[model samples]
Target chain A: MADEEKEQQKQGEMEELPVILQLRPVPAITPVEEQFLKKFRFLKAWESSMPTELFLTTYAQSVRVLLCHGGTPVTADTIRCLPSLQCVIATSAGLNHIDLTECRKRDIAIANAGDCYSENGADYAIGLLLDVLRQFSASDRYVRQGLWPVKGAYPLGSKLGGKQVGIVGLGHIGSEVAKRLVAFGCSISYNSRKKKPSVAFPFYSDVRDLAANSDALILCCGLTKETYHIINRDVLLALGEKGVIINIGRGAIIDEKELIQCLMQGEIGGAGLDVFENEPDVPKELLAMDNVVLSPHKAVLTPEAIVSLQDLLMANLEAFFSNKPLVSEVKDE
Target chain B: MADEEKEQQKQGEMEELPVILQLRPVPAITPVEEQFLKKFRFLKAWESSMPTELFLTTYAQSVRVLLCHGGTPVTADTIRCLPSLQCVIATSAGLNHIDLTECRKRDIAIANAGDCYSENGADYAIGLLLDVLRQFSASDRYVRQGLWPVKGAYPLGSKLGGKQVGIVGLGHIGSEVAKRLVAFGCSISYNSRKKKPSVAFPFYSDVRDLAANSDALILCCGLTKETYHIINRDVLLALGEKGVIINIGRGAIIDEKELIQCLMQGEIGGAGLDVFENEPDVPKELLAMDNVVLSPHKAVLTPEAIVSLQDLLMANLEAFFSNKPLVSEVKDE
Candidate 1:
């Protein structure tokens, strides 16, 4: 969990074990690499005494699969060094860190964390939403500060039931969030690029329309050109004075400056943000507000999700070795 | 809302309207007395210049309905003054406030909150459990204190999915908690006085055994002679160092002293306590711990739940006057 920069190697003595090449450690937060060591040997470029370029060239002809982490970018230049890399296994759902163009051009197959973190992501979104509506974090703070006795009853929080909650995306994670919110009796509508044929939740083609109707807008969409600063001033105003926003998606998906202003001006009621525009460095203004609950981009950092991710990564690697179709192949766009 | 000690009147002009007698304003936390004003007239004793006993004596023959709040006790002495008091309508689920013995002796019907707060209770229970398991309060605190960038990553939290959760007293609130947790993929088991005949959830007659098998124990049972201090040191030990305790039930259902020691000694994983044995005066020790989420017993204080309670109270009063069986009348044991 320390985010160690130095890439490491494990399991050297096994003679017939399958090998997976790594530019760096996959997912630096969890020390789950120890689990991976038992089944597959890692040929890490960062562990080499030689330069990384030289290390990659050494394995260029033989390396069939490459393991990529979110922190480490899989650049076209690096991909050019490996002539026979068949597939790229990613530790993140977002392909921003991995060069999809390079992979697509090379005809290299890919497997991201496909539904491996859907449950965790969904759970966190609802958790943040609940925290906002019920003022759980605020109540916890009042008690922790020994102010409960001094400050009488904390202000009453609104209920999740009978509230109209709109989801920003309705993909695997968004759908899971919708399902959980349904259990709380929240009516869920959603905004995706297009209306999902299988999803019954009412869909909005525009973000502004979704914000206008929703009591809270939970951001579950990925950050992209179309989605950058999607939650801007207009959306925040539409969400209104008593509305809340819970972001489990990328931080930049929201217009952070406008969000901060809305929170400060009480244009919006409250926010439960797991991701920030610049993670680790939250807005100074938000720290003082009891209405807002901030987290350091830890939506997918649950133990069960980690285990599932490890399984998915292992399965993808094994699938490549066995010449079987990948279990969650990233479809070619 | 302030806990107003002075009882006040809302309406006086309505003629031929049915009167519901109030010893005090029902449920002091919400100032929603205005809604009650439109329906019925109140014969409030506190508003009279005469002594309270004299006020009751004047209306003894005509005052057929009595209203009670949680803070205002309707003792046997008071009930004796109202010979025609045919029913007692309480603002709380617990009947300890009104003289249940006196009500039963006179065959006076009683209606408590019943299932009015059930949905809110369940929502808060799951919310607290999710807070404990996922460390939302801790993560929020870290970000609020400007520790995210300095701290890098918050510690990984355990997932709710695939974990065994045990409910203590699978009643109305407990059932709702089970329904929500199941949507999150949590396996639920319960321990009640007897296994619920209609419920398919695995049952344990003993609390200790339920704690031993559960990753978390959610206390949703009512506090009775059989259940007071049901969760003691032995139960906490059975729950073990990795198990969480979520108290949505009465505070005394758990032995506060033993729970504190468990949390302090790391005998239990954590706790999400909404009710403390001594509320408004939570133990100082629990205030400093990051693992515990302490709330001021606001589980059923949601806006929607309040409206539901208002409707239920009105329905019960109307039912009593219409010669119908009370919707949520407390059964004589």
Candidate 2:
């Protein structure tokens, strides 16, 4: 017993010190997410919203790295508070929230899980399309209201087959959405910044022209300064009465006031939205209309997406720690 | 001007024909639906609903055959009134609304478009499955209620992949539903009066056992005296908490009161209903729950289904007129 106690004490003395760092709340991470986190032996994981002071005090110790997930923006104050922080890993495609210039000045190696959410976003885009075309959501409401034996000309729903679908962005998610739409017997076309030779679909140089021709327009491109409020009143009006616009991209990509105006004026038939500009606070005007289907910014919260993101984040972390090329790096451009 | 006056007189004669059976309102009809009617020398075409007397008087004269569609039941009085009616072609699967006994006694041939609606029903079954499993409808409601940043631990929705789906019937629509469910990675099992040699899926001898084991139970069986209210309270109770029930068949096949009881007591998780016992007027109790998804008795009302049904009906009518064997004749078993 005495020898065992002495051995335990020696083992404790040789144990490595813990690395303390703040980890923000991520979407439901699966077993795969945990497996990736297991590699960081010296790090402490916080799965909830923690105060800045607590994070700073922890960073003052052995912590040299911090991780954020779910496209959370890392403010200048967050970085300034953690003096010892040298690395920031964000498990999301977009890094708009992170102050990259400050990170570069602080010599912090930054990486994000880019394009990992493409499949999830595309899946959601298809779901929204089906919901709108099939009138599933509206029918559900009607049924719940004891309005079965649907009034007027019953079963007036249209088939998704043989319709022209216009994709606003032919990026990772957009391309995937296009592929799925094709499977449903839809003709696909798109509008992108630059035309690509790889895609088989016809490309329109202008968004208005694309909208004017398409039965439905899907927004799946990344949000940028130039692309902000890109789908405005003129573009919506151009799409005309038979068009439906589905925004799975950033909400800022659409002009809310203009969209509301067009929807009210019957310029567009319907819309399916996921993300918003100032999220957790959608426009009351949009809610009042029955022609739109809205969702919380949870298009990328599927179990598959969570696991993929975790795997990508771990891959990035391993490369960073070993002084190898990071998996997903952001360029200044 | 004399030629034009002659043509107008001929057109007026054609318009005054006695037989005018209005089919369901559609933007257009397939060439097949119009084939039999084109052969009828005295019949005229109308786009509106027929008055009771006009319908009966037409059947008494040039309208030896009457074609019906949609859910309005043909009463015994209506059948008795049509003394000269030689045949009734119902372009629908269910015959509960049609007085088959009266037609049989009068030696009138009765045919219906049955199997053609199977694919349509299957499509709707999958739509409901996707709607419930993906929480598509629930999420829409949440967004509409101005509930942003959906609070608490959101319920984890299960993927259809690798789950067991039990079909209550192995008939045309049930089999079709099974085919689509299999594509979504579901393991299929079914309960039928007799085992089907064509299908490779396991057949359960008992309905209760099938209900107990299935993740989701889909009803696609026909309504008959022997099978009425087969999925009663006990069968539903056996399904337990995780089970989701979908009814694309006749609502009489399920005990509505018992189903509602189970839903209210939380014995079953959810249900997707397309028909009801006393339809066009759903039970007030069922309308109170958010767990259930509802659609009017219009599952097979798709354009594809409509076109197919009309074609089948026309073919049957042509065969009857030509003294050939009917394609889908109603048999007294």
Docking class of 1: medium
Using Cα atoms, each model's DockQ against the true complex is: 0.73, 0.30
lDDT per residue for candidate 1 within A1-333, as digits (tens), equals 333422222223443467788887666424766666667777878879989999889878778888887657889998899999889888887666677788889999988888988889999999998999899999898887878789788888988888999999787899999889889899999999899898888999999999999999999887767899999999999999999999988889989999999999999999999888777788899999989988888887777777778788778877888899987787732
lDDT of 2 by residue, B59-92 (tens): 4655667666546566678667667777777776
- What tens-digit string does per-residue lDDT give for candidate 1 at B202-310? 9999999999999999998877777889999999999999999999888999999999999999999999999888777888898889899989889878777777887
Interface RMSD of each: 0.9, 3.3
DockQ of 1: 0.73
lDDT of 1 at A120: 91
> TM-score of each candidate?
0.90, 0.76
